[model samples]
Target: MGMNYFHQLLCRSSRWERASATQIVPWALKGLDLGDNALEVGPGYGANVATLRTRVPALTGLEIDPALAARLRTRKFDQLRVIEGDATAMPLPDTEFSSVVSFTMLHHVPTPALQDDLFAEAFRVLRPGGVFAGSDGLDRPTFRLIHLGDTCVPVPPATMTARLTRAGFTDVEVHSAATYFRFRARRPA
Candidate 1:
């Protein structure tokens, strides 16, 4: 994951944290049951950890950056475990989590192929009938500007259903606004 210094600062900002807690997480997870075990992919700076940990009995964060993962571990988020690993190839066992979520992080995966692999990995870790949900911003000028010198292959909402379906997901639901998109899908029971 490539994070420019400016982007890193923005992610750690209070405004971003507040929006993640009050708006982003809730909007992506509306009407979704996170079940007893939930995994959050790419939880940079752990901005959403506080809110996500509350929704699920056990919440694990899978971060690719070792420093960020260590940072999260030190924060001592109750009911949260920080794991340093790539989402495309998580080290956890199969059929582990009941739900998988990634928020505003897909574009950082560098390529659509890896992003699709992450989707498949989420399916691999989820038990039968498990849900995979999250939100990502649509490609826009401001989004690209913040990601200058970083990996930013934005996932276009129109292509989401096809991609998730290719990863063996069912009940795929994609909702998009002018700037961002939210999605939900289920692994077949």
Candidate 2:
């Protein structure tokens, strides 16, 4: 799926860059075990990859955009592996990652059903006791404007919590702000 002009601009914007560093990366890193490998979905321009690599040395990023994935590879982080793939139907093995992370990207999943598929995929790839953490935008006008023509299904905290639980994630927690939300869940040990 090719990105529209607005989506492309957002991916390369400084605002987005700053958010990845200041907001997303820190939130995603919380409660993660450094000894375990990690995977990040939709890591645009790989901003979070460097920060995440500091904690989890072996970090792989799954980006849906082939162009973005190729761009990420050029950075040459020895511990970072960039894979061009879909989040809903990831081309990855089950129980492979100790943690799975996504940052403000779930809303781009087209529909709530597809977003649930992403949750299921995350659960499928996580090892027992593995953590899945991420932040996403709420259904607000400001965030909707940012997405432009892209598919944006801003999920509410309660809905997200329920979906995570249904996806077999335990210890699910969803925190909501006025315009955004963060979540953390664990695959049962």
Candidate 3:
């Protein structure tokens, strides 16, 4: 199975386990303020939601695959609501959330237009002054060897900032380390 398929399998498992401390959602969420009524796109194995909801009381996840959404619903995470939908064309209303986030999913979105659409949707859903933060694997040999879901577009931090700017997000910032890229963007109040 592909890396994406493996992630789906992990979601189906009863107990969630991450591959590393770095990959754990709690560590990723540290020092970040994910506002209330948050939306997480492609939540992968629902691990991030498990941690994110601790900080944001009303957290929802939009997963493209219905099966994954079903599995997540069964998990019964207290602050989590799972919906089956695509990020590029989200099903929710505009300005509905205080925050929007994604984890390790942008690179797999296929085309640049789709990527922009995903960001646009994120922007549309977020209230002014809200934030978006995520960790994505960069397109590099080591990352490719381990995580085939790494972006085909090689989203450098600058490129992500530019994209966020075009999507009406301001104060975009990126922090790169090892094989991953972390970014935070804010909607203007």
**Judged by TM-score, which candidate is best?**
1
**Poorly placed runs, candidate 2 (over 4 Å):** 1-3, 76-79
With candidate 3 superimposed using the best TM-score fit, by how many Å does residue 69's alpha carbon deviate from the native?
Answer: 0.9
lDDT of each: 0.93, 0.83, 0.75
Candidate 1: list runs displaced more than 4 Å.
Answer: none
- RMSD in order of candidates: 0.9, 1.8, 3.1
Ranking by lDDT: 1, 2, 3
Model 1, range 1-189, lDDT digits (tens) per residue? 888999999998889999999998899999999999999999999899889878987999999999898888987556488889999999999999999999999999988899999999999999999999999998999999999999889999999999999999999999987777999999999
Please give the range of 10 consecutive residues that has the lowest summed lDDT in model 2. Answer: 27-36
Error of 2 at 184 (Å): 0.4
Summarize candidate 2's per-residue lDDT along 1-189 as a digit string, tens digits: 345688778777778777778877687556657456899999877767767877886899998977788888887456588888999999999999999998888877888889999999999999999999988878877777767777777777788778999999999888876676889999999
Cα distance off (Å), candidate 1, residue 99: 0.2
Rank the candidate models, highest TM-score first.
Answer: 1, 2, 3
Q: Model 2: how large is the Cα RMSD against the reference?
A: 1.8
* Off by more than 4 A, model 3: 1-16, 19-30, 147-154
